[model samples]
Target: MKSVYPILILALVLLSACNPKSTKQEIALGDTIQTASGLKYIYLKKGDGRKIETGCKVGAYLSLKVKDQVVWNTNKLPDSLFTYLADYSRLIKGFTEVSMLLREGDEVVAILPDSLAYGAKGAGDIIPPHSTLIYDQFKVLKVDAPKKFLSDLLYADVKERSLNAAVATFQKITEGEESENYYTDSEQLNRVWEQLSRDSLYAKAADYAVKFGELAKDDRLKYRNVLSLESMGEYLKAKDHLEILLADDPENKMMQDKMIDLCKKHRMNNK
Candidate 1:
């Protein structure tokens, strides 16, 4: 996927360079050696060889600048690489390359050309076309691998989990009816998916909630699951969850009023 940051912010690249290990073949580019893919990567430093897996708890402290101008950067972003959902596909090519090379407590400054940086589109208007972007990435810390179910729960993998969860949810929503006959609120469904992306647990829980919503016949369980999906910024999902709960309990004026206020505050449709 392209950078998720707004156009003005400098999205990171995947790992495209590594330590000075000799390969069977080598090529050259301007001031850098080349690979068959036309990737001219420079290894600024070596990592400690600590492997980072998807869905692991990792944090990055870094400075980013485009040319001489500063774009957007986080002093330290506590990223939950823990879930398999947090994979290279969702990251930039250069970032993925570098991440593989890094271990716990590693750091490097990677210089990226527009081709490997943000490509022709660049990062919105902040990064110019064919411009170079620089990132000083540091693996400030990492949590121990998941020792329990929660870690496994947050682990991201390119599997059929999402599809299965969605199907299961649809089945429950339709009872004995076929999936083709279901009345799905697509906009609401998308909002739920987007909410999942904000953080790890919520993402996993949302998936579970969708699956549960599909399979569940009890109103009580759905209501409780919505509470489980709550997070710092998952107001949209919360409201949507509440709406589902409201469908089963129209007389619960307190929840109805709370949903109304949350919708108004979030500027989302109450429906």
Candidate 2:
């Protein structure tokens, strides 16, 4: 099925970036190659691996920048973008045109003009209308076998359907350079946890809270995690986590309040 892969979004609901390697292809490192599709790029490194083809599952890293502002960067994501070559649904608009021409381990600085990218409508508030996006840092990390892509896609589709549309497509767009969606940005993930908690999606909130804590330890997030676990009736987990927090911050009134609340709930449940 065809999918619309628009260009970039602020703080990175968009997609993935890797460190550039400085190996030149037939073209010099700084030489520009403009594809007929109007993609102008400079080769920073050339891949020595298999050339990417239509059926290949490509894993790549790229940072989308409109002028000096960052629309998205894959490096901020601990994972690379996993998609098929020429699959419009799985990639940025016009990026497939370039990906199909690349090979595993290739790195390029691609300038996707406004016309080829988001066009006049642009993306959300992050990308201005008619703005050109620059991938001054774009790298092809790996090319994998095609078989697993379908399974991964199926899993994601299932997860998206399990929740209401608004909750499932939770608005992750952030102002400025804060990260989005990925575990790499604890700041944005904490905000996401806040939203999920507000909606009382405690299970999902707990999941993200774990990842948020992993990225950066925040006491507030730790406390909120306990609340999520408590709401989900994982009382032991909640109490254990709270105990850890209290050991570190014994004077906190909020934790004390929760201890009282948990005790009441526990007694009521036992009775």
Candidate 3:
């Protein structure tokens, strides 16, 4: 019986160590900080460079876990880095708070209560509704100056409720840059214009598409311009731009289909 006592004690200790609840308790013991917004974080390694700034581009490696089980890891990402234009409104609240506090070489573990995370709706299949998220690791690798393009500034400005600033920034882009790569690619420009349209800045969005067509001398921008004009209910202007685009790429089946649709809409509007 004396020998069995020691063996039983050892078995109990082993079971406690293997229990998943222990892992959460261990993490909770780390130095913690709470924000007014209810976000809680623990600094595993605080960085020692300039702190992150609004509108800065951030590159980070993150691992998301729930209940001590990893749900996602940046290791699967190309180059193992997730680069984004940091806008607090567009990201999880807890993540935005931690990210704004970090600099290059910083690492942190953040616990996001449901309110600061996906909340009641949760994320898609991987995260359950009302689940608290554990960002087990976030390693900040780079914090870069804001991109030169005004379109890149729009979301942050809008989040800050500085719609006038966003308009001013877009105006600067319209002024044109000396660099030939001022407009990086057609796809990126199109996305920015789409965001503007969503924000109800349809006239500015259409103007950007038209101005980019002139600046880049790329007919594709005219196609985008037509779409923007259509969104604004300027069917006559849209049809005119569409005709210009069709003249440039008569064999483009997508443009041909758009032309057919626009003509039908235009005829209906005239009646």
RMSD of each: 17.4, 18.1, 13.1
> What's the number of clashes in each of the models?
27, 5, 0
Tens-digit per-residue lDDT, 159-238, candidate 1: 23554645545545456544333223332343344345444455465555555455544444355456555543567777
Between prediction 1 and prediction 3, the one with superior lDDT is 3
Clashes by residue pair, model 2? 16-62, 16-74, 17-62, 17-74, 17-75
- Model 1 lDDT-worst window of ten: 146-155
Error of 3 at 101 (Å): 0.9
Ranking by lDDT: 3, 2, 1
- Model 2 alpha-carbon drift over 4 Å, by segment: 1-25, 80-88, 147-271
Q: Where in model 1 is the C-alpha error above 4 Å?
A: 1-49, 76-89, 137-140, 146-271
Q: 101-147, model 2: which lDDT tens digit per residue? A: 78888999888888878888988998888888888787888885432
Shift of residue 21 alpha carbon in model 3, Å: 38
Tens digits of lDDT, candidate 3, 107-223: 888888989889999899999999899888888888876444444665455445555665565556656573332334454455666787788777777776676567657576667
> Relative to the true structure, how large is the alpha-carbon lDDT of every model?
0.51, 0.66, 0.74
